[model samples]
Target: MRKVVFHKLCAELRSRALLEETFHVTIEEQVAMFIHVVGHNWSNRPIAFEFMRSGETVSRYFNLVLDALCILARDLVCIKSIDTHQQITSSHGRFHPYFQGCIGALDGTHIPACVPMHMQDRFRGRKKFPSQNVLAAVDFDLRFLYVLAGWEGSAHDSYVLQDALSRTNGLKIPEGKYFLADAGYAARPGVLPPYRGTRYHLKEYKGTREPENPKELFNLRHSSLRTTIERAFGALKNRFRIFKCQPFFPLKTQVKIVMACCALHNWIIEDGPNVYVYDDAAWYEALPRSVRNHTDMHQENLAWAKKRDDTAKMMWEDKVGQTVP
Candidate 1:
């Protein structure tokens, strides 16, 4: 942030004639407006005081920055390359290529907010609060890829992705590449869900409400793949602290704040470890030791478990169904 602010934005903008988000404001003005929005509780009063600008001007410039950020985010937050194999590299480290075939770890989080009395019915979430449902995807790098805001809190995770996959052309992920999700979603060609069982962590289990079979193995791999999303969500909530609390804004504004936080997360990581005081210890301490991985819960059949897992499942699925090359 310091480098971007002090060096890139400040120094560079002053040196050149800058393009702007809107004709009503300059790029520098938009930056200031953006900083004020994220810095304050995004309240118009505070923004007016901080910038010594009228609320109207602040609102104008704030939207300009947000619009630009939205466009940038739409382009940048997408899966660029997907490699399915894990490659061992001697110098840099072991390369986890399996993540390449995967787009992101996806989960739906509740973003609370004030709602109109009449509209509140639709906005009521699983927690029974007035809010918006935010569906986010995080890559292995912990960078946010997709953020779907503006859904009513009552919406389910499966419904959220269904809209994204079916409606949005830009998000047209190839047929074979899959994303990791929790059991909130059902399994299909391009999405995977975790196993439902008394004993899990393996790629497959025979103890579901449904019949036990090789297909059940997909659930186990689903659990393993979906862990990344849980960790990502945990870290995000811990960092913001506000996500856990009810948002005071109206449902519309709440969506804006959620997207802004995602952008901020990218900004913080880009600034590196020192720019933000990331509570790595707090996060680890919060994790259930038994739930860290499937093995952490004491899986007795380790070797056999690995075998029944997805060595051929992904291959067979590709042979029979669609496979991304």
Candidate 2:
């Protein structure tokens, strides 16, 4: 984090009464300790040695800062807006009119978890070690809008998303606005997923084997847009060492760490310099948006399917029209 952003964060914490200076340790030191621990994935002992504080004091301050940051997450870790984003508008040839209503992109990533031996089974997924399925929504600028951490790694991404929607203050999609999701999620009104069993993912569309049909074209574009969430995850795991290493904190703290890390990521993106510059070339072809409707599940599925088909048809026709003499 930049010095100015760090000072502002400290000030915000003080103003909000989330954290305060103590007789021995200042807020700056406390926040620095927390950042060092997460950024380096250092244990309490190493943190204590580095900060010249006792292990107990280091642990206490770490938890305090973690809690404070999590409290701050409620505001910092939210969608920028429901309106059409400038990223699409500015790049008119890319995702502008096609994905106009796309509020953002969402996906789930597994973060290392520290769980009891008895509970490891539930937490362990395809990963050899136990992990948690963390769901997050990120805008075009690579800033997180919503984040739901602590689900068991074994849990399906779709299940985690459903749980998020079920919460009283969970993931929300404004009417007529939607988020791009991967094929792992079922396509609904406000969550647009690419066509299953179709040619998706940019790697597949490489070389001479380009999209052969409307569904393939749609899937290709969907993969291109939805890759934003993946890039966000990559940058996050790369920045925060806690996500890369095995967490030694309690299971609950591990979960909070996920949230805290996401909040910090957004903070760095907004306040700090452009560390992770948005890749224009990578996001050349993009995604789709959706509407908020609670009609019958079958009907809603068909509606969204038709929506995808229509968008794909339009994209394909444009491609063909441009090629014609």
Candidate 3:
């Protein structure tokens, strides 16, 4: 980390009195220890060896830093209003007008977890490994807007999404705003998903064949935009190695780490250097394929389906003049 960035963090924490210098340890060292543990998934023993401190001391400071970072979550993980003017000029600007009310993309990712033997089965998913299902929503800037962790890995994406929507204060969509999700989720009034039985992933569009119809065109654009959340997840795991592997911590601590990592991710995007670049293809290839049951569309679902169809038709008509036969 740069000196300026380090000092800025120290200033913020110091102002909040969330972190302070111990008898022999400065706030800088404390912050460095926490970053090292999260960034590298280092155990207390190895961290103690590196810092020349006792294992217990290292563990204590680690908890303090973890708690402090969690306290900053409210300020870090926040959803911003969509900027229509900016979106119209963005790299994916052509499709911006069609999804003018889109807030971000939503998806679920599985992170390895360590649970008691009796509870292991509930956390084990298709990967045959115990894990936790983490649902995250991210905007175009690659910042996490909302994150819901701690769900058993065996939980389905749609189930987790329903949980998020059911909570009184959980993931809230504005009156007209919607979020882009994949087929694993049920398309509804507040969420837009690609048309089923259609090419969605970027790898599917590698050949000379392009979108043949309006639905294909809508799916093509949706895939392009929804990819931002996948890239965000990739960037998050890449920066925090703890998320990449199962850390030797209690289930509660592990869950907190997930939230803290997300909070830090947003902080880095807002204030840190712009060195993080997302590899869409790499992330897509790493994902595990799971079979999802087709959700029966009901009354509300039908209305949402009609809305999606209308949007697809509008987009196709707007670009029909430029499309080759």
Candidate 4:
């Protein structure tokens, strides 16, 4: 982190009165300690030894910073309306008319977690280690709009998404605006997914294998756009090393750490340097493909399928007209 960014954060915390100079530890040291904990996943003992303080003191101030960051989350992480008209009118070619009403992309990522022996089964999914499934939505700019963490690793992506939709104050979608999701999620009123059994991942569309049909074209574009969330996840995990490994904190504190990291991620995106580069090819090759389940398809699901078909047809016709020779 830059010194200017660090001082800026200190100023903000001081303005909120969240941090003040202790007798021995100054506010800057407290903020630095918090950053070290989140950035490096340093345990209380190591942090205390480095700061010349006791483990108890380090733990107390660490929790205090965590609580403060959680409190600031509301202001930092938010969903703002994108200007559809300007986006379509701009020079950005592929996303113009097709993604006009699209607000952002949504996806689920597994964050490593440490759980008790009795509860490890529920937390351990396909991965050998225990983890938590986190659902997050990010806009084109790579800023997180909404995040739901703490779901057990074994929980399906659709299940976590369903929980998100069921909450009274959960993920909100405007009437016409929709978010692009991967095949792991059902294409519904507020969520639009690519056509099933089609080429969706970016890796599938490398080189001469371009879209052969309208559905394929839509899938290609959808994969390109929806991969934004994966890049967001990569950037988040890359910035905060705590996500790379399972911290020794309890399950509940681990959840809070996820949320706190998200809040800080957004803060860096907004104020920090433009260091987060979205490497699509590398990211696509690294992540495991999400398993798609088509069971229990309902009436609304059918309607969403029809909606995708109609949108694909419209995009194809538009492309044909533009390429007329």
Q: Best-fitting candidate, measured by lDDT?
A: 2
Q: Name the candidate that leads on TM-score.
A: 2
Residue pairs in collision within model 1: 82-100, 83-100, 195-219, 203-217, 203-220, 203-221, 204-217
- Model 3, 129-218: lDDT tens digits are 899999999888888877899999999999999888766546766666788999887778679999999887878878887877889889
lDDT at position 44, candidate 1: 78
As a TM-score, model 4 comes out at 0.87
Q: How far is candidate 3 from the true structure (C-alpha RMSD, Å)?
A: 7.9
* lDDT of each candidate versus the true structure: 0.57, 0.83, 0.81, 0.80
Please identify model 1 stretches exceeding 4 Å from their true place: 5-29, 39-42, 84-100, 200-225, 235-253, 267-325
- Residue-level lDDT of model 2, residues 38-69, one tens digit each, is 99877788888888999899989899999999
- Model 4 agreement with the true structure over 130-156: per-residue lDDT tens digits: 999999988877888788899999999
**All candidates' TM-scores?**
0.64, 0.91, 0.88, 0.87
Model 3 poorest ten-residue lDDT run:
280-289
Pick out the ten consecutive residues of candidate 4 with the lowest summed lDDT: 279-288
For 1-325, candidate 1 gives per-residue lDDT tens digits of 4656334443333343333445555566667666655554466777778768798887766665555555444434554445442221211111122234566677887776677789888989777677778788776667776788888889888888767665533234444456677767665545555544533454334455532344453444445556666777777676665576665555666677677667666655555322222223232122121334546433432432343346435534543553255
Which 10-residue window in model 2 sums to the lowest lDDT?
A: 277-286
Q: If both were scored by lDDT, which would come out higher, candidate 1 or candidate 2?
A: 2
